[model samples]
Target: MIFDFNKTTDISGWRVVDDGVMGGRSQGSFALNANGNGVFSGTVSLENNGGFSSVRYQTDQMALGSYSKFVLKLKGDGKSYQFRVRSSFRERFSYIGKFETTGKKQTIEIPFATMYPAFRGRTLDLDNYNGETLVEIAFLIGNKKAENFKLEIVSIAVE
Candidate 1:
């Protein structure tokens, strides 16, 4: 298991990053709900060119060469989101895959081989995820408009 959220899970490593870093007015928050699931919720404001909100977790490098995909157990507000990863935290770009939630519980599986390299919403010419090692993981919502989003995540695992 890569990460799981339960009644006792410690989520201190998780952080919310909005468009404020680039002069945007987005606001996001991450926390465990009463049911013990990790909740990522926020408003994506287009004010000041801001239109994205994300939550990220950085961890020790994990060798995952044997894992071909990641499975996310989550519930969303019928919106779209990006699941992202970085082999190394120092890298400026992340390998990302987009998924749409159905406003109900769902298991989203993202193949490591299909995550393309991207930076600031632009796809890079580099190859896709190598599935060798990972140091960071994130979820981002940025549909290019102002809206509110909420995602309840039960767990994240690779298989």
Candidate 2:
């Protein structure tokens, strides 16, 4: 699948998620440049002894037992970031992964099997995401000081 930013249908399946818990101080955040190319702009403050802060975009539904990999075009600050996905059957997530940014537009491809584990979040030994319900896509800042980060997702596809 090819995702075009100018196409509304391509972005309809996505949602935004940010800091803080439900109904709380939450993450120190805001939306930036709604009409511009940069829709998500905010500082990922790892404050209050915070380790991870992120934004997630998800599809309304998923075609399980089908796709093999997830691909996207992304640009980030001069730091590393984690890409997280959830299992359809669990509250936490079955898989989690880390990837570094080039500070430029680059294609990041993740195979379902190898990208399903992390240092945080729930754990599950899932072999394939072939038909697993696509839950969420998260960009996380690891446990550390405030990391001023930016991510512009130009496109996303499954195959």
Candidate 3:
């Protein structure tokens, strides 16, 4: 099943989870655009050790073990962003896949086998993402170049 933004009128569980949780100055916001797309936009500040802003969605655990890839329909500023998925919500780390945007709309496919497990800012040498169930998903931008950024997401699907 796909998470279709166009068909969703209320993005109730989506929330901005920025560096502020760690006393950073970065700020971000998540909202639904008029086109019913998910919009994540905000400024990433370097003040107080802040360097990233993100938005996350928590959903019922989904068994994605059968899927080999994740597809995202999005438009973003010309920059790189991380797509993260977590099997356990209590874990401080997540499996991350980094992709660069082209400043235009596109469908990007990320192979599940390529995503690496990371904690804080360091990549763990543990096994790659092989989670059977996913409880959370997030998008984060932290190029370390501090700038205002925007990303519009239309849909996310597993295949």
Candidate 4:
């Protein structure tokens, strides 16, 4: 199933999550472009205990019973971003999948079996994601440095 941006009127379900939550000074925002794609842009700062910036989309439980991969169509600024999946709302850690962009539009395929569990940048000893449902998804840019970032997302799907 595909969540096509062109069919949505606004990015109402998306929200920014800067480091300020932990007393950091980073800033970020999410909005829908005129073409219906979602744009996640922000500045990452290492000030005041901050080291990361992200945006998350809360979705209904996604039953990926037999799906093993997630496909993302997007454009980025030649940087790396972490794709996170949460299987439960109260889970402290998320399954993370990392991908790098080439400064051009492309499709990125992330396999569930390759995702690792992590919390606050620390890798957990738990096994890779083999969950049947996903409650949330996020895109984070936290390269341990300060920088500006912009990512345009066309669609997200599972197959």
TM-score of each: 0.98, 0.71, 0.95, 0.95
Candidate-wise lDDT, in order: 0.96, 0.58, 0.89, 0.89
Task: Give, for candidate 4, the lowest lDDT window spanning 10 residues.
Answer: 1-10
Pull out the clashing pairs in model 4: none
Residue 44's lDDT in candidate 2: 53
| Model 4: per-residue Cα lDDT over 50-104, one tens digit each | 9888998888887898899999999999999999999888887999999999999
1-159 per-residue lDDT for model 1 (tens digits): 888999899999999999999999999999999989999998999999899999999999999998999999999999999999999878989999899999999999999999999999899999999899999999999999899999999999999
Q: Which candidate is the best by TM-score?
A: 1
Clashes of each: 0, 9, 0, 0
lDDT of 1: 0.96
| Selected candidate, larger TM-score, 1 vs 4 | 1
Q: Where is model 2 more than 4 Å wrong at Cα?
A: 7-19, 22-39, 118-131
Best by lDDT: 1
Error of 3 at 136 (Å): 0.4
After aligning candidate 2 to the native by TM-score, how far in Å is the CA of 110 from where it should be? 0.8
Tens digit of per-residue lDDT, candidate 2, span 10-126: 344444454455332225332333433333445555445444566666645565467877787766665777777765535555366667778787888878767755434555554
lDDT for 69 in candidate 1 is: 96
**Any runs in candidate 1 off by more than 4 Å, and if so which?**
none
